[model samples]
Target: MFKTLADWLAFDVFGLTAESSMGESVHFFIMDITKIFFMLVTIIYIMGLFRSFVSPEKVRTYIQGKSKFAARVLAIVLGAVTPFCSCSSVPLFIGFVEAGIPLGVTFSFLIASPMINEIAVVMLWGMVGWKITALYVASGMVVAFFGGIIMEKFKPERWVEDYVWKIQMGEVQAIEQDNSLPARHRYAFGEVKEIVGRIWKWVIVGVGLGALFHGYFPENWAASLGDANNWLAVPMSVLIGVPLYSNAVGVIPLAEAMLLKGVALGTTLSFMMSIAAISLPELLILRKVIQWQALALFTAIVTVSIMLVGWFFNIIV
Candidate 1:
């Protein structure tokens, strides 16, 4: 249905030849932008209804009370559900700490928040398939789960900035929320508005890049990266992605294009994860809460873990 609409607009209405690169790119862009925004509004609103039941303070209290494994699991799950980006890192990190959540478990939430989310999952399912989406979600969980455990082993608390420790976190008073149907609907609408407003530009940029790659990138050049012998592709993808800042919403379209153009599955996954998870902007924000040492360690652990995930997928799939 979307393809038909895009084709009409691009080829019939605009009168561009279907064979032309500009026509194809225009179609790709139109189709994706329309489909993505429609899905985002509908789905995010639904998710927002459930989100009203969960708050950051509540999450912190729950994690603080759970066992080690449970805390890690909860953290990862919450991270995936929350619509947080790197911009929220500093305050979220501080809130977790101030709430007395374990450093390791806190690390898990931090890792998963930007790297994996409902929007990304839905977008991937639409662009790729459930099989690849499952793989992506599984890999993200594993990285967050283990990354937290490893950071705990490093005695990460010692590396936190002195200011964080000095600042006292007072007890939070829980406020009752309205759970009436109308209120829930209002919350859902607000979420749709806020989330769509925040990420719509990213969706445009992402789809634009995807369209360009789909229409103009050399197929043979892209295929070369898929070669089994190209071991460096995984690490190189990670390295390149680290400095770039984007949420999963922005990166998924580019990832879809790479896969369509013959980039190796694992390499593409690595690039996507690195761009969403370990962006330099995120690290710079984290610097305010943690010292240089902790920041370096966080970067190293996530980078290495992402690289491993890439190589592992390359080997198996």
Candidate 2:
């Protein structure tokens, strides 16, 4: 159905020859945009519904005072589900610290929240194959879990800002209350609209870039740089991705384009993870709460963990 609609728009309505390059690019663009937006609306709505049942306070309470292993695990899981982005980092960090959730546990949640969002998972599953999607999620969870543990071992409490320690959230209350099923669904719909409105343009830009690469860019150059035997490919991709910021939804199309142009699975995934998890903007947000030394340590831990995941997947996949 999607292909047919794209075909009609590109060939019949746009008057482009079906076999021409422009025609193909337009069709691919339209098809991808249609499919992605559909998936985004449906999946995000469902995720929002699930998110309604959980609150940051609940997560903080659950992780507080748990065994190290349990706390780390729970933090990672909650991070995966919580609707957090880089913009929320400072406030969430403060809340976690004030609630007595360990720094490492909070870091685990922070790492997983952006890197493994439901939108990213669904897009990966829809755009790539299930095996790759599964690998991405598993690798992300591993990175979050181990990264948090490594930071915990370093004990960087002294690096936190004095103001962050002084500021306290007293008498935490659950942010959301139980509502009728219809009300919850209505709230979910609003969430879906807000999220889609926020990222839809990026989604288009990503898909347009992918379409251009698919139709115009020379494959040979990309293949040479992304050569599987080149050990540098993964690290290079990570380095390139870290400085830029884009959500998983925005990056998926570009990732798909790179993969189709012969990038190694590990290299492409590493790039995507870096973009989602460790952008410059996120670092700026963290700087508000952490000293330079702690920030550097956090960055190092995440970068190393991501690189390790890339190399492992490169070998196994």
Q: What's the TM-score of each model vs. the native?
A: 0.93, 0.93
Model 2 ranges with Cα > 4 A deviation: 17-19, 174-178
Cα lDDT of model 2 by residue, 178-242, tens digit: 67788779888999989998998889988997888766777786887577778798889888888
Q: Residue-wise lDDT of candidate 1 within 205-284, one digit each (tens)?
A: 88999999888888887888776469999998899998887768888888888998889999999899988887777777
**lDDT of every predicted structure (CA atoms):** 0.86, 0.85
Clashes per model (N, Cα, C within 3 A)? 0, 0
Model 2 residue 178 lDDT score: 64
- Cα deviation of 153, candidate 2, in Å: 3.4
lDDT, residue 279, model 1: 70
